[model samples]
Every structure is written in structure tokens, then in C-alpha cells.
Target: MEDLRGAFAIVTGAAQGLGYAIARAYAQEGMRLALMDVQAERLAQVADELNAQGGDALPLVVDLADAADTERAAAQALAHFGTPRVLVHNAAILINRPFSELTLADWQREVNVILQAAFLLTKAVWPLMVTAGRGSLVYVSSMSGIKGFVNESAYCTAKHGLEGFMKCMALEGRPHNIAANTITPGMYMHTPMSERNYPDELKQKWVDPMLLTPAFVFLARQDATGVTGERLNAWELSTNPPA
Candidate 1:
């Protein structure tokens, strides 16, 4: 395992689900955290819990879909930690509706949160990572980006765009030692959103979000050198990490 003690990380959508699991893993590794989410109360509670455990966690509540809000949140995190060594773009919204039924607003909202927000946040932190000459950017991608899914046109489109965007970022960041990659969680988990859409039995068969923590931790490690612009399977990497 790569040692990440004394480093700092920024995790978007960290109030719960996979984002929360990633943050907890980072905290366990002694990394300070800036947890961003739209849920103010939940974000504060998560931050407080981590801080109580002798971890440095700051909660910033902002609508990530808004470029201005994302920029401000990024500024706050940077001011608090100077330059974070890791950034995980984990915020996403899924409006599951058939293409014929989906409204323009629905498509726009999903795109803004999943693709546009990632762009804004990455842009906000890009300079810092370059200045430090090293960093890691892990995008929380999904199978929706790789294959077509019914009633998920908007989500799929945004994720596909995210993958392409990360590839471009990887090329640009290569010179700066900033690794950029996409991690696709192949199955659903017991997230609040998933719970609403999936039956209990189906959810039980799915992998737990925490099971993918190792993959995120691995990608966030400063020692993770020469790995960029690649698409990773979280389930696979969790059991068999890259050397």
C-alpha cells in the first residue's frame, strides 16, 4: 500500500454512498479531507464524525451543478488545505427516463452535474496540481458510459462525455505528474438513490460501496506513478491492484 499520511484530498458528493466510503478510507489513511455535497446537514455530520475521530475534514455544501458554486467551493477547499494531493469527482445525478419521455431540463440537469461540474472543479484545481507538480484525479464513472442503458439516455451521455474529458485531462496533466483516470463501478450499491430505484433483493445482490474503497485509495496514492488516462474497473482493481 502507498503511504498517504499528511496529504489532503477533495471528494465531491461525499455526504454518503461511494463518495463517503472513499472519504472514510482516506481518513483511515490519515489524509485530511474536504467533503463537498449539496446536503448541508449530512455533509456537516459526516465531517464532524471524521473530525471527532482525530481527522481533519471540512464540509462544504454547494450545488455542484452550478459553475459559480463549484468554483467557490474549490476556492474554499484550496484556502483551507493550500493544495490538495487528490481530487475525486464523484458527484452525479441520474434521472432515469426513456428518451422519448425525458425533458430538455432533465437532460441539462444531468449533464451539468455529471459532466459540467467535473469540468469546473477540475479546472479550479488544475493549477494547484500543476504548481505542486503532482496530484491524482479520479472520476467516478459507470457502465452507462460504456454501454447503452434503457431509460438512462441523459446519464449515459454525460458519463461518455466525462470519460472523453478525463482522457484529455490525462494528456495535459502527464507533464505535471497529475494522474487522471476513470473508475467504473460495474454494479449498483445501497445508495439513497439506488434504494429508491431498486428492490431490496436486487440491492442485496449488488456490491457494497465500501468494497471499492481500495481502488479509490490506490488511485489517490502519490506513489501511483505512470498511470493516467486509463479506464479502471473498481471491482477488478479492488482485488488486484496495479503494481
Candidate 2:
């Protein structure tokens, strides 16, 4: 485990699912948090839970699709938490529609949430991280980012774009003691989104998220040196039962 006692962090899409899990992991290690999302009620609930665990967590609700809104949201995070040492771009949207039936707006919106939002958030915090001379930026990508998936053209394109974007950021940010890495998590069980897509029978056979939080903590810590522009898979990393 890496020492992160004084670090401050920000997690987007933190209302539920992967975002919430990431935030909780940081909180457990005593990292102050800025949780941003569109879901006010659930976002607040997450914040409260972190606070209950004796973690400092701030909630900021904003629509990432709007450029100005995303920029403003980042500003809010900085104002509330000072310069964050860790930034996780975990918010994303998926439109599961066949290529022939997908609309132009659907494609645009999907890309906007993943690619544009990451750009805006990173840009907003760039100066702060530069001034601190140390920071970590983690992008929550998917297997789709590295490969293709049915009914996932828009999502896949946007996630693949993140790989390129994060690599470039890693190169530029490295000179400033900042690292950027992307994690391409495979399908997992038990998230708000999963409640909609996963059946009860399938949940038992999927990867449990608890097993992956440690990697997230490592990435956000100082010990993750020289680990930039890399992609990780949770299921593969956690397969220890002779699978």
C-alpha cells in the first residue's frame, strides 16, 4: 500500500457504480474527495457515506455533456478541495443500439460524455497539477476501447480516443511529476448500471468489484511511478482461483 495521507482527490460519475467504488477506496485510505455527477440525490448519498466513514467528500452535480458545465464543475472541485493530487475520469455513457439503427445524435452524445468530458476535466485541472509538481490522472476505459463490441461503435470510438488522449497527456504531464494511466475494466457485477443490464443469475458468475479497488488505490498513489499510458483489466488481474 502507498502512503496517501495528505492527498486530495476528485472522482467523476461518483454517484454510483465504478465511480462510487473508486471514491470509497480513496476515502478508506483517508484521501479527501470531490465527487462529481449528474445524480444529485445519489451523489449526496455517496458523499454522506464517505463522510460517515470519516472521509472528507464534496459533491458537485453537473451535466458533463455541456462544455461550460464540465469546466465549472472542475472549478468547483478545485475551490472545495484545493489542488487535487488525484483525478479519476470515471464518468461515461453507453448507447446499446445496433449500428444501422443508431442516430447521429446518439453517437455524438456518447462521444461527448467520454471524450469531451475527460478533455474538459483534465484541462481544468492541468494548471493545478502542474503547480503541485505531482498528480495522477486515471481514465476508466473499457475493453471496448481496445477492441470492438456489438452495438458499441460510439462508445468504442470514444473510449479508444481516450487511450490516445491519455497517452499524450502522460507524455506531457510526466515532466511535471504527474502520471496518467487508463484502466480497461472488463464486465463486472453489482453497479447501478448493472442492475439494469445484469440478471440475478449472471451476477454470481461475474467479477466482484471489491477485488479491483486495490489496483485503483495503487494507481492513485505515489508509488505508481513510471506507470503511464498503460491499460489494465480487472478480471484478468484478479483471476486467482485457478481460472
Candidate 3:
């Protein structure tokens, strides 16, 4: 495997959950990091942890839903650690209400936070990737994007839209050596969100968080060249990953 030492990377929603795990994985590999989240307090602690471990890390606290906020996040990240060689759009908001009960604001907020945020971040980073001639954007989409579920209309819609956006980005970005892909993780264990919503009665279905870090490292590696527009599942890859 190629060494990621000195490579700069960005992981959105890095204050907790899968995003935190992703940051740890990258830091272990010696990647300089720019971690973004809306939770300012949590972001501080995460940064301290990474820095204590001798990883170069910068934490940005901003609401990702606003276009200007996302723009600033991208700018601040680049300013702090130079341009990121890898960008992971792992932040998402889930609305678990019945279709009939969902409001316009609920739908719009989900779309703005999930899809628009990714677009803004990608657009901000594209010029840098073009200059460097190498970059990758990974979207942490959901299985809901592929298959529907009840009471998650807004979440499903945003995730499905991400697929289409990623495909187009992959096609256009390939010429600039900027690849785009998505990862749909199975039910994750011990994330902040999971801890909040998962009940003891439903613990049987939760997937181990440790199993996810490897695939992330692999996908973001230099050897992952030409692997654009692909959607990978962590569970499927654990047993029979693509070569």
C-alpha cells in the first residue's frame, strides 16, 4: 500500500460517529486532516485527541446547510492544511417521520444538508484538485438510496439524489484526476446518532464499527485510481470486495 503520510484529507461530520472513525483511520496513516462539524464543543475535543496522537488536525465548526457556510468550511480547510487530496462527504441528516407528516422545511433541510453541502464542498475543492492533478471525493450515502424504506421519505430522497450527483461528478472529474464514489454502510454500531435512536431491543442488527475503517482507507488510497462512480457496501466488501 502507498503511504498516505503528508497527504491532506478532509472528513465532514467528524465530531462523532463514522466520521470520527474515518478521521482516526486517516490520522493513523499520517494524513493531515481538516475535520468539520456543526457541534463546536465536540469538534474541539476531537481535535485535541487527534493532535495528542501527533496527527495534524484542524477542526471547523459550521452549519453545513447554508451555502455560504459550506463555502467557508472549504476555504478554512484549505487555508489550514493546504488542499485536501481526499474529501469525504460523510455528514447527513435523517428525518424519520411518515411521508404524510413530513413538512416542506424538513424535506428542504435534508436536501440542503446532504446534497447541497456535498456540491458546495466539491465545487470548492475542484480547482485545487485540477491543479494538483489528483483527488477523490467520497460520499457516505445510505442503502436507502438504492432501496426504499417507510417513514424516511426525505432521507431517502436526498440519498438517492446523491447517487446521481456522484455519477455526474465522476464523469466530469475524471478528466481532472478527481474521482467521486459513494459508500453505503450497513447499520453502524456505537455512533452518536445510533446511540440516540437505537434501542436495546434492536441491538441485534447493529454492525461493528471497526469493520468499516479498512474499506475507507482502501478506497481513499492512491491505488484506488480509476475507481470512480462506484458504490460500495461495507458488509459486502468484508466478505467479497471488488478488486
Candidate 4:
């Protein structure tokens, strides 16, 4: 395994939930961080907490749905830490509105944050990762990525697009030794989004998001030759990592 000590990582949606858990995991691995989120105060608190624990964290307040703001955030990260060992695009918004009730603006915001921001962030970091000769890009996906749900028209569409985009990136990145993959929670978790969406039954079975961070930490050590273009289960991978 690659030595993650002092490695750099950029995590979006890092103010709370799964993203927060991943940030903590990276910190424990001795990785420096550039955390992006819309929640300014919460983001600073997380950064302070990590810094207090001997972790290096730079908190960036950004609205992922705004293309310009997303680009600026990526630029700042690059300036602070030249090339990231990993880029985890975990920022996504889910609004449960029926098709009949959903406005075009509503659909656009969700797609912009989840899909458009993915493209923007990846595009900004692509050259750096290529020059560095190795990198891992992980997009947090879900069952909604492949299956349709009752009130997730925009979300499902963007997730499906995300999978396709990763496939293309994986194919292209293979030549440059950059790995690209999508990962689903695989099991229910106690996240802000889950709290809003999960039923009582799933909540009862839900585990802490921290339990799934091992899979992410493993992926952080990978290159194109290691599990690219795959849709992985975080729960399964964490339970039994690759040999």
C-alpha cells in the first residue's frame, strides 16, 4: 500500500455526514485536506477539529452549484496543495419533489451540483493528476444511480450520468495512470441526507458513516491499474478489503 502520510486530498460536501466521516478518516491516515462545503461555520468547525487533532485542513466555503464558485474552489485547492492524491466529489443535493411539483429551476440546481460540478472539478484537476502520473477520483453514488425512485427525477438522472462519465474517464485515465471509479454507500448510513430520506426501517439498520471510510481509504491508495471504472460497495469493501 502507498504511504498516505502527508498525502493531500480534496473532499467536497465535507461539512457533515459521510463527507465529514471521510475527512476524519483521511486525517487519521495523516493526509492533508482541502474541504469544500456551503456551510461556512460548520466547515470551519470541522477544519478546526481536525487541526486540533494534528491534521492539516483548509476549509473552503463554496456553493457547488455555481460553476464559477466551484472553479474558484478547485483553483484554491490546487494553489494550496499542488496535486491531490485523491479527489472525492461527495457534494450532492437531493430534493424530494414529485415530477408534477418539480420546477425546472429545482431540477437544474440538483443537476448542477451533482453532475455539472463533477465535470468542472474533474476538468480543473485533470491536468494536475496527469502530470503527477497517479491519482484516484471517487464519486459517491447510490442505488438511485441505476434505479428510478418516486421523487428523484433529477437526482437519478445526474447519478446515471455520473456513472457514464466515470467510465469514460477511467478509459482515458488508464493511459495516464489515473484511476476513476464510483462507489455507493452499499448499506444504509446515518447521514444528513439519509436522515431526511430514509424510512424508519432503514434507519434502524443504518450504521455510522465512519464504518464505510475504510473502503475510501483503500481506494485512496489505488491507481488506474487498481479497480478503475467499477461501481463498488463501500460496506463490502470495508468488511473485506482487496488482498
Number of the predicted model whose TM-score against the real structure is largest? 4
Output the worst ten-in-a-row residue range by lDDT, candidate 4. 218-227
Cα-lDDT of candidate 4: 0.94
What is the alpha-carbon RMSD of candidate 4 to the true structure?
0.6
Using TM-score as the yardstick, the better of models 2 and 3 is 3
List model 2 lDDT by residue over 134-201, tens digit each.
88888989877889988899999999999999889888987898899888666565776666766688
Instruction: Give per-candidate clash totals.
Output: 0, 0, 0, 0
Q: What C-alpha lDDT does candidate 1 achieve relative to the native structure?
A: 0.88
Clashing pairs in 4: none
lDDT (tens digit, per residue) of candidate 1 on 1-243? 667988989999999989999999999999999999999999999999999999999999999888899899999999998888889999898998889999998998899989998898888888989888999988899988788899999999999998999899888888889999999986667787787777778877877789888888888874236678899888888878777
Task: Please identify which of the two predictions, 1 or 4, would achieve the higher lDDT against the true structure.
Answer: 4
lDDT, model 3, position 93: 84
Q: Please write out the lDDT profile of model 3 over residues 117-157, one tens digit for every residue.
A: 98999998889988888888899898878878898898888
TM-score of each: 0.95, 0.91, 0.93, 0.99
Q: Which stretches of candidate 2 lie over 4 Å from their true place?
A: 198-202, 235-243
Ranking by lDDT: 4, 1, 3, 2
The root-mean-square deviation over C-alpha atoms between each candidate and the true structure, in angstroms, is 1.5, 2.9, 1.9, 0.6
Clashing pairs in 1: none
Query: Which lDDT tens digits does candidate 4 get at residues 58-147?
Result: 999999999999999999999998899899999999999999999999999999999999899999889999999999999999898999
Off by over 4 Å in 3: 199-201, 222-224, 238-243
lDDT of 3: 0.84
Winner on lDDT (2 vs 4): 4
Cα displacement (Å) at residue 174, model 2: 1.7
